[model samples]
Target chain A: MDKKLEPIVKTMQEKFSAAHEEFRGEVHVFVNPEQIVDALTVLRDEYKFELLSALTAVDYYPQTSPRFHVVYQLTSLANNVSVQVRVPVDGDSPKVPTAARVYATANWRERELLDMFGIEFEGHPDPRRILMPEETEGHPLRKDFPLGYEEPQFTFNFEEIDLRKPYVKE
Target chain B: MGVEQKLGNMGVVTTTLENMVNWSRTNAMWPMLFGLACCAIEMMSAQAPHYDMSRFGMELMRASPRQSDLMIVAGRVSKKMGPVLRRLYDQMPEPKWVIAMGDCASCGGVFNNYAIYQGVDEVVPVDVYVAGCPPRPEALIHGVLTVHEKVKAQKLKDLAKS
Candidate 1:
């Protein structure tokens, strides 16, 4: 693990019983979804990880136990060190405590996670769809979300497509 | 100067109203100053001194749709932007022409997804499709000239029918 991240990882493991792994000189400390806000608050207030550089999620399809891993990459601008906090989320209507109180940037990042991965951030202020249009239905980043496509209009079916295609009548 | 000298004392220069109207419309078409994406850069270059869009009598791009006679859709149209594009198209006066000035505006290019409207034609009628991933300034000039040609061929009787 990176020299700067080691102490923080050790501290998280000791205090919250969070599991951690080190790879390629970087550390990932996995905390329970319910304890995410507390963990993030501790990191920000005590460890000086004031900047939430990124808060995104990864979908792990076929892994029902925990279908998503919401990642929070925190940076300590004063110390020039960055650490990652991960919260594993199960697929069935997964919810996690909001870290907005800990980091202001988490507000928009968490909204994006809600929009893309369908992860609910409890206690998030002004929670709304961030990226996608207001009427968009599914969480686009989810594995089951359809990658909508258009049918190529070849010469053979060009006439057929013209009939069904939603071109402006005027 | 030359026309005056040629006319001499025979001061009658008679022409049909249709010919006069079409000629004036083709000479001074005001395209709306709207740029959606990268293709807009090429469109600007076309308007700049190097390509000199003024030679075709397009002195200035109208900032408002009400004043413009043509719209050059110069980039990808996102779903969110579709309604806005349609609203602007509706605001433009009749006899206005649309030139879909890039692959994205013409047929959604490679962004064949839900986020991007498949083609701007789904929102407004396109008079011409200039095929390029942001075509060169020369290509845009050619598209503008093509629109002029289309205007020239338009029949007054057809305008009345519409």
Candidate 2:
């Protein structure tokens, strides 16, 4: 955490004071769906947080209000500082603005987040499955999914492996 | 029935050739190192010190398909990587062995999702399947021993042919 980023942090805190009253220092203001892309753009162009290292989601199921938390970790190579931004969303129609325009790297990361947490990246160019198949019914990373599912083993012929054998008693 | 008769009646050269084959098979088992996911860490651990797999004669890890004799599919294989896995298997030299290292590689572990190839054996022929979430180092050693036994049996049969 450098002294130079203090102004950027303060500006962000002041701008989104309404939506993000629970803002901390290193873990910056966690905004809602509406301001996500704008905030990311400002962070990148204005503040020089050039690298969007990782975008992932954490499922908070069985809870009342927010069912998922999407986390975006950004790093500024010039300043050598990092910040984490989180946005909580409802499971039924979870949606967030795409950061693809701000950073090209967010394309696959957002798709993966969608695949695992079922969160929608609104306005994303090509939102598709990255890990799971296209027709996969449920997100396997979800806690609700069973870890181990029992199924029938594939049958194989054993007699084919015994071609050269003739019983020779010792 | 004494030493004189045993020396004179050395018939088929069975014992000598069988011993040589067993030694060669055990000495050089070149495993094709396949790292698919997280369990690859443990596979790497098995290769590193403390568990020093070099002692049992399987420390040589070949990156190329032509040179390697064994393939250790160390983690979960995604649907995308399935064809690649099969292609690598096809490229390897004959008389090759495959070891399915983790729960993911053996079977699709925690991911029952459509993306994963349920088990690597679905793509390639696996000789020994080491069982664990990521099988313990000792369990991997056991799988190595199992492969050794299969190799020894094959060698003896080959010797019997000549």
Candidate 3:
């Protein structure tokens, strides 16, 4: 609610007039995915929202349109303020531009976003799984992934196999 | 003379021997570092300065199974981690104790997902079950004390037999 940000809001409202408005900030406006990178570059260079606190995607599957939403939370540590920007994308191709140029911390968060949600960061330096093993199929944290797939492959036969017997090679 | 020296000089042979045994056992309770999830945070907190667990002499947390005498299963054991956990239990030396430190560790709490192992006791022999989503630090301390009591009882039984 700073007096200075009044003109910035006016400028966003004037320029991206057709963009679907989800939320607004002291000086910023959340725009569609088409204008997200442009809006971010403006905020970083012109408006000084210099820190990207966190970035992640929320999947809203089975929906007819906009099946995934990428959330970008940026901050101005010096000013102690934050703004959340969400961009809805198609489930088939979840792609977004990397914010590494804007804030260095987005490098890892972008990679996690790609690995976990299957979102592609267009210019991400290293997009890879952060938690799950590379061999692990499907994102385990997703709502749809089955909990325990099948019966275990191994078990002990404590009764049948005699521990008392001398060791013998199989 | 110090209290320990006075106790030694007083000719209380049985009590002195018991104290000596307890002192050594309490000082060397090597706990297995098994952090499964969020409850691991509470486990870390209990180890921090405010709790000062070193006072009762059980602050060493060993990563390897061979060296540890106490296994603190600090969070939910997922189906994936179950076999690995069992392997660790088997690796520990005999006379080792297992502490199921949370509701999840005792009986797979809120994460009733098929992925979670219902109860760790189904796999390993649990000596103490500290019941809570994440048990308070005092509860963990009580669980350790209970383990100490059990150890003392076993020692006394061994002495009686000898």
Number of the top-ranking candidate, with TM-score as the measure: 1
- Off-target runs (Cα >4 Å) in candidate 3 are A1-6, A9-35, A77-83, A140-143, A146-170, B1-28, B33-65, B76-91, B113-118, B121-125, B148-162
DockQ of each: 0.55, 0.10, 0.10
Worst 10 residues of 3 chain B by lDDT: B10-19
Per-candidate TM-score against the hidden true structure:
0.91, 0.61, 0.66
Encode model 1's per-residue lDDT on B50-146: one tens digit a residue: 9989999886899899999999999999977989999999999988999999999988898887788777888888888899898998898999999
Q: lDDT: which candidate is best?
A: 1
Q: What lDDT does candidate 3 reach at residue A114?
A: 68
Using TM-score as the yardstick, the better of models 2 and 3 is 3
Q: On residues B113-132, what C-alpha lDDT tens digit does candidate 2 reach at each position?
A: 65676777677777888889
Fold similarity of candidate 2's chain A to the true chain A, as a TM-score: 0.79
Ranking by DockQ: 1, 3, 2
| Candidate closer to the true structure by DockQ (higher is better), 1 or 3 | 1
Ranking, TM-score, top scorer first: 1, 3, 2
Give one clash count per candidate, in the order shown: 0, 0, 0
Q: Show where candidate 2 strays beyond 4 Å.
A: A1-17, A23-30, A45-54, A62-67, A73-84, A88-90, A123-126, A133-135, A143-170, B1-29, B37-67, B76-87, B90-94, B102-126, B129-146, B155-162
Per-model chain A TM:
0.92, 0.79, 0.72
lDDT of 3 by residue, A38-110 (tens): 7778767776778877688777766726877787777766666666667778877777777776678888887
Candidate 3 chain A TM-score vs. reference chain A: 0.72
- Residue-level lDDT of model 2, residues A1-170, one tens digit each, is 45876676677777765233333556545777788788888889888899998888888778736888788889999988787777878778788889888899999998998888778888899989987667777776777765544453434533332221121111
Per-residue CA lDDT of model 3 for B40-158, tens digit only, reads 88888888999867777778888899999999988988756877888998999866888889898876777766567666876787888899978998888889889888776555556
